[model samples]
Target: MKIKFFRTIWWKLLVSYLCLILITTVISYILTTATFRTIRIKERQMEIEIRVERIARIIGELCKEDEKIENIKGNFNEIARISGIPLQMLNPEGKVVAFSRSSHPKFRQIKNINLQPFEMRKLREGKKFSYTQYYGENRKKLYYYICPIYREGNFKGSLVTAVPLGLSRGFAIMLLNSVLIATIIAFILAVFLSRSFTRPIRRMGEAAQSMAHGDFTKKMKLSRKDELGFLADAFDEMSSQLKRNIESRMKLMGDISHDLSTPLTTIQAIAEAICDGVIDTEEGRKKYLESILNQTRRLSFLINDITELSKFEAGEVKINKTLFDVVEPIQRAVESAGFLAGKKEIQIEISIEDEKLQALGDMEKILKAIQNLINNAVQHNPPGTKIRISATKEKEKVLFSVEDNGQGIPEEEIENIFNRFHKVDKARTSGASRSGLGLAIVEEILKAHGEEISVTSSQQGSRFFFYLPYLDPASADVFLDK
Candidate 1:
């Protein structure tokens, strides 16, 4: 269970944060306690040293006045009483002479004393020194200091001072309690912060699950300015894209069904009419058969275009690139689409500012794109309309255009003209069997070639144009001569 708990990021983060705070608090407690003990001991030692030196000085002055140890013992006892600190006087032979307890109000007898070897050595050296010792079953600790007494350069005795080790227990306890309380508060804050941080990620995970189940409506509600915030933004963008793709695909399916059914229904009706002998004349029958064929061809064209466009969108179509005369394919497209123009008595005009302009691209796809544009122009224009095809070398690229003197596209509708299944109003496309995929396919093909197609239309006419990279302008004369 502990292992499993640690495996979760929430628990891990909480534990990590808590551990960090706990370690810091523990270290601080140790340092604070140690420092307090050091400062308190030093203050106590300083007070003890002053008291001991005063007693030693008094004893030395009395001895100089010819006062014996027994005579000065009473004076030492009185000095210890006034100082309010436990003190002992040891003879030169290490025998106790006087004690502060002897003069205490509760006990009027002298207290016994024992000196360790190191302590005796410190006294003999007449050096002031301090040390800690523990006594009794509970090991109550005490800080002891020794100050030496001397008269006429002869060691007289030592005055010792003792103080309980704990001088500020109340302050120490308060500080410890404060640190512990702060640590607890920090742990609580860690829990809340970790949860807050991971909440958005958890929500995002659930949202992703919903998306996987075909529900893109669940969105994360997070507004933080961090890496996590950026991740949330990306997740929302992905959800939006998924929703759009699904909706657009559904609409495309419906459009495909309607478009397919229209041709199929026409073919079926024509076949039924011919089979039932509704058309008596053989010429009429032939016309009906041709109509069926045309419908079938139209159906085939739509399906093929749809399939090819899907491949192009999916990045599955490979372009075969080669350097070719830009005019060659445009010229071919003109001649092929000329018949369609001739049907409506539309004259096709061609122009080339640089006849030697060569471009690098897939010739077949480029030809198909040019033919699509020319067909679109021919179908939309009225009889006796003029459609102009022109190519010119501009800087490092060759600009190709197809302009038609027909009813132009509206400014508002221009942006979506290249969208699949998008068609202008029927008034602009009368008598044209437009699957509405021609311009879209052209756009995709040109895009695959690292190019773009755009349009500008107004009251006079509509011009569709794009640029292709030139194959080396310096070799223009060589290509022109070819």
Candidate 2:
């Protein structure tokens, strides 16, 4: 169970989220603790300074009474009581003159030392003093402040008040506990938040992995209307398109194989007949060989068409943006279709409102695309059927259409006529000299250059229309097939 959980993305996401929350919480706790500790120390120092100043006023007046050493000792007791802390006054000779607990015998033995930096500066200026960290006779830590007791603004003995930071230490410990508790809470929240944030991304990753494994059925479905949502929608669209392309390619392969197989099978029979001494005339052998060569050439053309379509799709075939006469490429396609028209006894008619209209695109590919449409109309029509070619410029776009007065496309299947390998009748399609990829190739080539190709038909005839973005005559390539 543990191994399975570890292998899954959702579990991994949850664990990672928890870890992030804990890390953030720990950082916050540390920062808060440090800030609180600094505040506490500053407050303790201020309290000690105030106590020292209060005691100094009484000591300076009493220390001047040369007759009352014992009275001064009693005054120190009063100082300790009022200050709410230990009070000790040191003389210039490093002897304790007045202090709480002065009767401890070691108090007289404990030696006074030079004042710390803050204390010495205060003493030199005859002002109140402060010490941030001080040590006592018993090696106890204290926060202290001192002041010079004075008369008539004259320097005298120093008065010091100290506070054992036992309470402050306890407060610090309490703060640490509070910080730890808060950190734990924050860690939990961070984990939850991080998991929530990463859930969509993780799903996307899974979807991508699935696609890599050739499963393009699932879509990334994120409900958020942010950038993630847009990404999810794009991913879904990509998957669907990928699936469709795969299906189309598979269908094309099947159709092409079926078409090629027939000719190949016939060639094998003809070869077997020649080996078995069935054909005696040189002309009959020549005809059989020519038929095989024709089929081979047809296969080559189909392969070339597929390759060119892929190039167009990949944008490897650059659209040569030239403003030339649209009539030029149209005439080229019409000329190419003439041979097929002649064979079928089909009369192709052409009409144009403006022959000088131009469009921006690759002329070669455009001509090929146009040729495919015209050839299709000519090939499928009855020998006497009239095929029409028309071109017009509309709103800065050029529309070229090939119409045929032949067996019209069925209403049900016209929509899919341009699909590769799709046949109105597979048996009829098989006998046809060309592969069924003609219109499919044309459609793809047009789409690659950001052009539009569509088919509309009625009971009378079918019209195939394609539009290309127009270019000004100044920029168009002028290819006149004179």
Candidate 3:
């Protein structure tokens, strides 16, 4: 599908990356400019100080030769023009004895020179002095360096030099051009990175669309080890699980229709046969009526099992837990299935490690789970098969097991035995009442109690076992009182 530009993750990631880069570039530009400006100003101040000292030494030499200021004024103007800085000759009394003429407009506006008291005192003491001041409408910075000129070991005067620290127009343009070029390069890189970041998300969206249309074959070929890779792996797992569930549901529907149709067709046929007088004799009629009744009962059992499994899968079945002697339910379940086992000549052996072993769970459900397991063994196995039922105390829990010595389950079919409507022996026609939901329901009952059931099978026999939390009789009473 063609996604809207602004609504896609690619567009959003691109915008976010560009915004971050832009902000970083602007901040970097401002800080860099400020830092370079400060360094340049310091360098200029140092250079001007050296020049002022040179002029001071020259003036001292001129004083030794001639104390008259006119003799040195021509040299001062020459030095100022060469250095492009204005110079002033100040006496000890803070008066400008001579000053250089400059072509610069700002220097021309200087009518008189007034030194600060501290600066004059330092010069009189034969030491150097320096200060900075701002001038004009733009507040341009000007640096002043004053060094003492000495003649015959006595302080004669001081020489001053003034230079502006304003940054040049050419330098400012160069910095701005560098920043613009860097920003363009950064934005281009951001575009590629954004595309790489959003590529997986786009593929996942396409995969989801394919899944919606019942196609489950698409795979994301990302091989990254980051969070995006983890998310992609999770997506693939979800898709696989969804496909399996859909296939399982389809199989379950077919199995249910087949199971229900058999009993229903038999009941319909028997009823119609009796109605059409096909069996006129009383004995034949009675036998046909009994067959119809049996079919109806089988239909009822299948519907009830299906409903019970639906409730368990939907989490509609609530477990009402209480502490009860585990052996009581085991014994009761065995006795209830005694009639069926006797009919099939299946021998059931009970082995209880402790008759007083107590477990915490819904007693009725536990009984039903045991009964289903026992009945399953009897119906599936041939006559004379022996089923062993055992309950034993194991540390903090009680282990219950049912083992039958018969043709064991195939290894490949063991994994699917707990799935609803899955029968190990698909060709068996003797167990007409079996709806194939017994093991599935048994599994659900144990799961609702926060336990798991496991099976191990060999050619000799198959054993199904599960554990339940055990409680002593004294503790059971204490719990009931609370």
**Structural similarity to truth (TM-score) of each candidate:** 0.86, 0.63, 0.82
Instruction: Write the residue-wise lDDT of candidate 2 on 1-482 in tens digits.
Output: 12365676656766776777678767876787678767766777777676677677767677664543344777778766666666667664334566776322332333253565665556747876554454556565555566776655666667766555433567768877886787678667766765677678778888988999999977887788999899999999999999998987787777767777877787788889888878889998898888778767776776787677667667687666555677888888889878878988898888888877777677887888888888888877678889888888888788888999888888999877776666676656433346777887788778777777888888788899988887665544344211
For 175-254, candidate 1 gives per-residue lDDT tens digits of: 98899899989989999999988788778888998999999889875788899998999999999998998999999888
**Residue 77 in candidate 2 has what lDDT?**
81
lDDT of 2 at 55: 72
Residue pairs with clashing backbones, model 1: none
Please report the TM-score between candidate 3 and the true structure.
0.82
Candidate 1 global TM-score:
0.86
Q: Model 2's lDDT to the true fold?
A: 0.72
Which of candidates 1 and 3 reaches a greater lDDT? 3
Query: What's the TM for model 2?
Result: 0.63
Best-fitting candidate, measured by TM-score?
1
Which residues of candidate 2, in runs, are more than 4 Å off? 1-133, 137-167, 184-241, 278-301, 314-345, 353-364, 392-398, 430-432, 448-450, 467-482
How much does each candidate deviate from the true structure in C-alpha RMSD?
A: 4.5, 7.6, 4.0
Model 3, CA-based lDDT: 0.84
